[model samples]
Target: MAQPTTSILCTDLGFEWPDGRPVLSGFHLAVGPGRTGLVGLNGAGKSTLLRLIAGELTPASGAVRIAGELAYLPQDLTVASDQRVDETLGIRAKREALHAIESGDVDERHFAALGDDWDVEERARATLDRLGLTGLHLDRTTGELSGGQAVLLHLAALLLRRPDVLLLDEPTNNLDAQARARLYDAVAAFPGVLLLVSHDRELLERVDQIADLRDGEVTWYGGNFSAYRAALAAEQESAERLVRNAEADVKRQKRDLVEATQRLAKSAAYGKARSVRRNDPKALADKLQGKGEETAGRLRGMHTERLNEAKERLAVAEEAVRDDAEIRIDLPRTAVPAGRSVLQLERVRLAYGGVVDLELRGPERVALIGRNGSGKTTLLRTVAGELAPAEGMITTPVPMRYLPQRLDVLDDEATVFRNVKAYAPAATDNDVRARLARFLFRGARADQQAGTLSGGERFRATLAALLLADPPPQLLLLDEPTNNLDLASVRQLTQALAGYRGTLVVASHDYPFLREIGITRWLEWDGGELHAVDPR
Candidate 1:
């Protein structure tokens, strides 16, 4: 295959965890201009590779070669609450320098700092406006901004830098639909080498190509996520066909060996019988019998060799096949019968100013969607009884569980088994183990500390604990469930929820995920109220 000219290159890159577990080894990648979506399973080193490229981590071996200036937007964007919006935008000093020079202070340092960037504030404002942050004032502190707003502000800062290469690792994780759309636009507008590591299907759709990281190597695929899926499907089909043909060949070889052995035995016996019948001399007949035995042994060895070669070919063919396992489980105990009233809120005034008057009934999968800071998370929290409404009565008749985005349900120090056991104290250890196995945490996997788990594993552990609680949670509230999750994890979560026979309220920006899980109703939080929207 012909390769693109290298703009960002990682040659023989290698990294290992502190505990000595190797991640990338002798890995090589070369990407040119245009957005490249780096995708893989949770532990496939997507984030690690991004970090390496951004120079946040030193590779244990090999080198990262970049053609120009680079900027990185990490998954967790941290900004101090006291930081001014201008600081977050990376123009605070320039603004100060310009102001000082305009105020008649003839400081050479101010002139040097300003450095002909007189329109710094204007550019900052323009960038912020482009990212849908027009209302954000440069003087305002980051504390006044919502999480999604902060992420956009950080991106705006990166834009102000005007880098030649951009690396975004799960940049849309904390963003809402509106925010994500704005980010998508910014990503599309970026005229540079772009490397994005994300599971956001929509964000990935904006990419020029996909770099699939697996088993410490990258396989490039042209086009977006859907195209990549189509290619992967085709590849899998071919691999499966090869495996089937190889299996048939092995079977034919085995049959041939068996038939050849049988024929050899029959011939040998016939030869012995004929020698006895036409024996001129006993010694001559014995010599003839020995010769026949020698020929039979050689024939057997040849057949055995053929069978072994066929088996090796089968193994090689099987190695090309992928094992993408799905999570499967039954939640019979969580079933809420039709017409069962799960929750009710009467003129509920949230602490953040929203008035929610809502009622939920049996097995209704509700999608709670809105712009960031529009109170989706707050509403979910209120329903889960984590927060008391300022005014009004909130009632949930059945037991409920809330899975927050942080996945704080599990104790970081505890094992997955122990975490689930904590939620279901009455259940025996064997019962917990059996249930954990369904979440793909079997045997030693269940014994690992929750803190050490990847994003997908952590989510599964949290979900398992919540669903396996003492009363089996007749109502489940999930806040941003798909945020930062890999595509496979999202699929697993969707499958798990498919079996959930209770009232479900999922606050997420992931529309595709909402659609996949069969959301029966759509509720949008706007103007300080929850309004029902057409399911379409």
Candidate 2:
């Protein structure tokens, strides 16, 4: 595809929180027209860069330059319940003016308000329809729509603007499979400068290239998500090889230094014996000794310099290698025996009107798949005892724990250790600390307050607390667990879950994640009932 005329440029950009914590410092980026997937670990400043470009935030230093108009759809989109759909789309005045003109109002202001957007309503509806939001009334309030529908509606409004540059942050976070497909189409069709910040791999695959933001710097890659992964793997392999070579060089240098020292010691000893045998004058012997000492000093200095240089190279090579740690956990206590009655629900009416009649035995990993607002969460909540079922009986033979999407299970004021300790009250503090280390929270990190930890850290802490509960829950329930997680964190979550041998029920739209965690059974919740589905 040909490039658009638009561009985004950031020159020596700098930003810091009011508390003096710096995020970006002297950052520079220039992106011409192309779909660039911006990705990094959580809190790597992807969203910050987008917000800076969108002018929603003021950088402490430098400037953001754009060739043309820009539109931004932030991750946390909020709409008042009473806000009209037309008003949200930024066409209420124009729509009213068009109506007034059609009704024989000769007011000059009406024509000015309508301006050149004569078919604004048609265009708005078309945009909505393209995003799978057809039949939505412009006069309706935003509160009437589901969360996913509201997100699509906001995106439709942005599309209607037809700006030269578009910024999207976690656009697919709340979208279902169907809605996400529509979004992917819209994104692919956008003929402008597009910068996307998302953890959704499927969405990232649609981008023309990737701009990996790390440590307040951007590294450009020349293809989509899959290509980026391939290139990154190659780079990492080369980096690891370099590190190995550098380490070998350092060891060789050290060995050479040792051998040289040994040779010098031997040479000095022979010279001393010769001096003694020759019966040379004291001054001559002293002069010989001084020369030997000088030579030895020079040789040692040269070897030391080479060793330092080798060590420096090794440090640089090591820096090029990424160190994303994996979570390693063992929860034998959580394992459920075969033929064990994990959970049973008989004609259970969900809060949202869905009926579930199911019995899970043993350590079955069940994936509850469905569209947004399809009562998956309601069913999970009901199973967790967070919500009362409208009707029917529910039973669980083993202890259970639920990790909600919001991750509001911990007390903000308490430390991570305290939180886990709260769950495992009978366990010793040392024991809890040891287990927390397996979750990548070691020593003092376990003492960090839950409120102060980053998104990924908080998640790990929450998972540790749940899995390490006093009774060691034999049945685990998770609702939208992958929803705001970065890719690395998601992998870590998967790793942690791999060790869990209990019955698992997860409600999520992340298919790849569901597969990675080894979901044994697929159940689709639709039309107020659950139905078995093939994985294919």
Q: Who wins the TM-score comparison?
A: 1
The lDDT of model 2 is: 0.90
TM-score of each: 0.92, 0.89
lDDT of 2 by residue, 277-365 (tens): 99999999999999999999999999999999999999999999999878988799999998899999999987668788999998999
Most lDDT-accurate candidate:
2
Model 2 poorest ten-residue lDDT run: 451-460
Cα displacement (angstroms), candidate 2, residue 39, comes to 1.5
Backbone clashes in candidate 2 total 0
Displacement of residue 102 (Cα, Å) in model 2 is 4.3
Spell out the clash pairs found in candidate 2: none
